[model samples]
Target chain A: MLGKVNHIAIAVPDLVQATAAYRDTLGARVSQSQALPEHGVTVVFVELPNTKVELLEPLGADSPIAAFLAKNPDGGMHHICYEVEDILDARDQLKAAGARVLGNGEPKIGAHGKPVLFLHPKDFFGTLIELEQL
Target chain B: MLGKVNHIAIAVPDLVQATAAYRDTLGARVSQSQALPEHGVTVVFVELPNTKVELLEPLGADSPIAAFLAKNPDGGMHHICYEVEDILDARDQLKAAGARVLGNGEPKIGAHGKPVLFLHPKDFFGTLIELEQL
Candidate 1:
């Protein structure tokens, strides 16, 4: 159902602080920040040897990260992404097992320009699970 | 400061159910369960080609996972482990940069038999970060 962890998403109240911590302090190779208007968040990828870490900041008031930051304030781990060979197959299987696929139960293009779907946090034991087609 | 993600730990109220979800439903290779009395948690590793997922259940009433599950109810992503080239170097740099290392600021042998230290969740934007010496 899940291939590998594509990236772990962290929601930060301050993108500059988050970026500096990972890039300058952690000495991780970070990509330039990219704003995803569709997702209503700006993101930067911290490249690791085996995987990547995604730092997300709210783009607008309506951004979901805005709500997350409202509660967390200091920011926190938002969600995790897992790569799947075929997202449709994964979704079908997970749904059959009573997992709730979010957002109209359809896959949408994600930051990597790949098909992705979100599973409800309740279904995933309080962890928002993202499945990306690799 | 960090090498690669060692594993993602999820605090589950029931380890058997969590193991079944990952192994039986998701079809991932799982290792035998192990109890870490020092950490007060029972754990199992879900092996993936790229990395591993650690399922944690409270081993005692005072277990940290017990409190986490009490709040979340359905369980949730607990902490993330990142591998480090040198534990001392990583700790010194993180401390110098104003990050708080948890529990006496010393490394302890983790489930993988590697030197590990936890960074304060507050310093890490509400995300508990574990650094393992690779």
Candidate 2:
């Protein structure tokens, strides 16, 4: 049910510094920072040869990543996303296997405009997993 | 300088349970556990289409991930590895750019038998980065 890695999300305190670190220091192509009010975070994509590294910053006061950044002040890896063929089927299978899905077990349109669902970290070795419909 | 994402490492407290979560629950092809005493970790590779997810468990008392697991008992994302063409050049460039490489600033043979160097997480938005020579 898990396909290619969609992206690795890293929540950072500052987007500009993080973007410059990836673009200038790391020598990677980075996209412009785009704010997603719905998701409550601003994101920049660091394009790698095979996958993407997403730099995220809290957008609003109630941003989902605010609490994470508060605990990890320097920021840290927030979640790992994997592409799935059928997200509903994947969610059902994961649920049947006693895996907990986040947000009422409903798939929401993600940053990439694709249906995505987050799985509880405790169920997957403390790794927050995001399943995005491919 | 950086190429494909080599793999994302997740430090886990229990290898068997983590392996079962990835294999049985997540439905991903997972490799047999391999103990790397030199690196002080046992690993299981979750084969993704574009990249791999490395599940790391402390091998011995002096395991590098021991402190990390102690801090995060439930396990967590340890590091992100990116492939590079020339590791020495990459290290030199990263050093010149003010990024501190871990250890004595020399490349060590990683678990995959490739020369790898770890960068200080503090300088990279709190993300431990590993650069492996491809």
Candidate 3:
């Protein structure tokens, strides 16, 4: 069901600083900041050899990551995204196995414009998992 | 410079349950638990196509993750490991760039028998980072 790790999303209070840290300090190629108003977050991609590290910042008043930033002021790893061949099949299997799909249990177009669904952290040992259709 | 992401390490309170969640529920190939007493962790590797997810459990009273697990009882993402060409060069460059290295600033043999060094989370957007020589 699970394929490659698509990316690890890290929520940060400041996107510029986080981007600079990964680009200048860590010597990694980072992409420009992209604001997703629909998702209520601004993100920058830290491109690694094998995967990506997404640095996210709250965008609007009701940004999903706002509460997370409030709790983790300095920011932290928000979620891990894994790729799947078929998201609906994956969601059904996960649901049958007693895993809770977040939201309406329907896949939403994610940051990469792919269908994605989030699983409850409680069901996965306190780790928020995002399943993206590859 | 950073290479591929070596692996993402998740510290779990219960290794058996965590492994089962990945194996049985998520349908991923998981390796047998390997106890690294020297590092104070017992870990299982979740084999993914592109990279690996390391599930860790505290191996001793003095385990470094003990404090982390105490705060996050349900377990959470511990650290992100990035592969480096040379550990010493990476450490020196990171130090020069004002990033603080954990411990005595020397590379220690990590779980995979590679020289690894941990960076201070405070210096990296509150996310623990591990640099492993590839």
The TM-score, computed over Cα atoms with residue i paired to residue i, of candidate 2 is: 0.99
TM-score of chain A taken by itself, candidate 2: 0.98
Displacement of the residue B21 alpha carbon in candidate 3, Å = 0.5
Q: Which stretches of candidate 2 lie over 4 Å from their true place?
A: none
What local lDDT score does residue A66 receive in model 2, on the 0 to 100 scale?
96
lDDT of 2 by residue, B30-116 (tens): 999999999899999999999999999999779999999999999999999999999999999999999999999999999999999
* TM-score between model 3 and native: 0.99
* DockQ values per model: 0.73, 0.92, 0.92
**Model 1: per-residue Cα lDDT at residue B11:** 90
lDDT of 3 by residue, B4-123 (tens): 998999999999999999999999999999999999999999999999999999998799999999999999999999999999999999999999999999999988899999999998
Clash list (residue pairs), candidate 3:
none
Q: Per-prediction fnat values? A: 0.67, 0.89, 0.88
CA lDDT scores, all candidates in order: 0.87, 0.96, 0.95
What TM-score results for chain B when candidate 3 is compared with the true chain B? 0.98
TM-score of chain A of 1: 0.96
lDDT of 2 by residue, A70-119 (tens): 99999999999999999999999999999999989999999999999999
Question: Could you tell me how far off, in angstroms, the CA of residue B50 lies in candidate 2 after the best superposition?
Answer: 0.4
Query: Which pairs clash (backbone N, Cα, C closer than 3 Å) in model 2?
Result: none
